[model samples]
Target: MKVRAYGKLNLTLDVLGRRPDGYHLLDTVMQSISVWDELDIQTSRQPGVHLQCNKDRLPTDSKNTVYRAAKFFLEDCGLADQGVYIFIKKYIPSRSGMGGGSADAAAALRGLNEMFKTGLTTEQLMAIGARVGADVPFCVMGGAARCTGVGANVEPVAPLPDCWLVVCKPPAGMSTPRAYSILDQYPLSSTQATPRMLEALEAGNLKRVAKCLGNRFDETIRLAPVRALKRAMVDAGALGSMMTGSGSSVYGIFVSEDQAREALETIDSMGRTFLAQPCSGI
Candidate 1:
């Protein structure tokens, strides 16, 4: 079976607090973008997970998150007796505030569940995913959500307004580990994105939602050139704009798809751009 693993962007990410376990408590609103990676999985007569990457950018070994996800699922289901070969075709940009790797891992779990008839419940799948990475659980269960408790506790929320997104990625990639380290050095800013955007969403007010969108990490990440790209989008008449995850990639929301395409054209003149709509559901 084959699956398309959709990438995500955080329209509103607020670090609520830090946990005793060194993980940061979060109140984030994340939506999958149209950007995705293609995964092909088939049963193998062999006894271990084997991975192949068509994209040169990603690793084709156990170190890769997709391999680890396959390993985790097979072991958890006592299907270690079985094996599968995964062929990955990457399209989403890595380490650019997009959940490329996480999405791939999530897709693997979903694919294996269907192909192997594992019968693992959603909660069980999420639990296994959490052991792999913080973002894995959410990707396994897509759609808009309010994530807390180191991003594992997910509360399904109403779908976000349909808006076009223009994303710009700079040449430099921001490491998540390094971003968290710098976060500790700075004083705690406001964890305001969730509450404000939640109100807008409940009201189904697109204008208000656009106006209220924010990310706390932007306060620190704005020093990079990607910020300039966001500013440029605003100059081109974006309804609202912000950096998605950690840093190095920024996006602007527009009222119409046409406007978004125009904004993308502006970015394409200078840098890479992804034009996509808000994902409605999984």
Candidate 2:
């Protein structure tokens, strides 16, 4: 089975609090984006997972989310004796906070379930995926959702208003763990971003949606290049701009593709940029 793993953007991300297990509770609106990675999977007579990725730096062992997804799915389905092979053609940049890894893992689970005819429902896949990563459930469901509680609780919402997005990533990558550690050291700036974002989405107001774009990471860790990229997007006619995920990648929402393309050119020199739009859930 072949599956596509679409990337995601954070229209609003807030850290509600930390749990006793040290997991930070989150209340955020996540949207699927046109950016994606593709995976080809098939069952093998061998009794272990085999993974091949286009990116050499990516791990292919148990540490790899793709491998873990396969292992866990097989074990869950009483097919642990079965083996699978997966080849990932990656387009999404890693550590961009775009849920690339989680998307890939979700895709792997979807493909494996189909390959083995496991008959697992979407909810079942999501439950298994949560063990792999918090963003996995949302990615499995696709479209737009308001996710909370370590990202395991996903509430599907109205799709984002049709718009173009200029997504740019600086060369500096962010470590999610390190960012969370740093974020804990300081107080937050705003906690209402999710509610405002939900209101904007429900109204289908692109401008309001853009204005509601906010990330707690942006307020807590003001990376120099990230701020610059956000400015460039606004200067090039974006409705509003903000950093997505933890730190590195920033996106600007635009009402039209032409505006987004122009903004892309404006930021072309500043970082690795892409012209993207909102994507529906699987």
Task: List per-prediction Cα lDDT, in the order shown.
Answer: 0.83, 0.90
Off by over 4 Å in 1: none
Model 2, span 85-123: residue lDDT tens:
899999989879888899999999888888888899999
Q: Any runs in candidate 2 off by more than 4 Å, and if so which?
A: none
RMSD of each: 1.4, 1.0
Please provide TM-scores, in order, for all candidate models, with all chains considered together.
0.95, 0.98
Q: Which candidate gets the maximum TM-score versus the true structure?
A: 2
Model 2 poorest ten-residue lDDT run: 183-192
Lowest lDDT 10-mer window, candidate 1? 219-228
Model 2 residue 117 CA deviation in Å: 1.6
Positional deviation of residue 77's Cα in model 1 after best superposition, in angstroms: 0.8
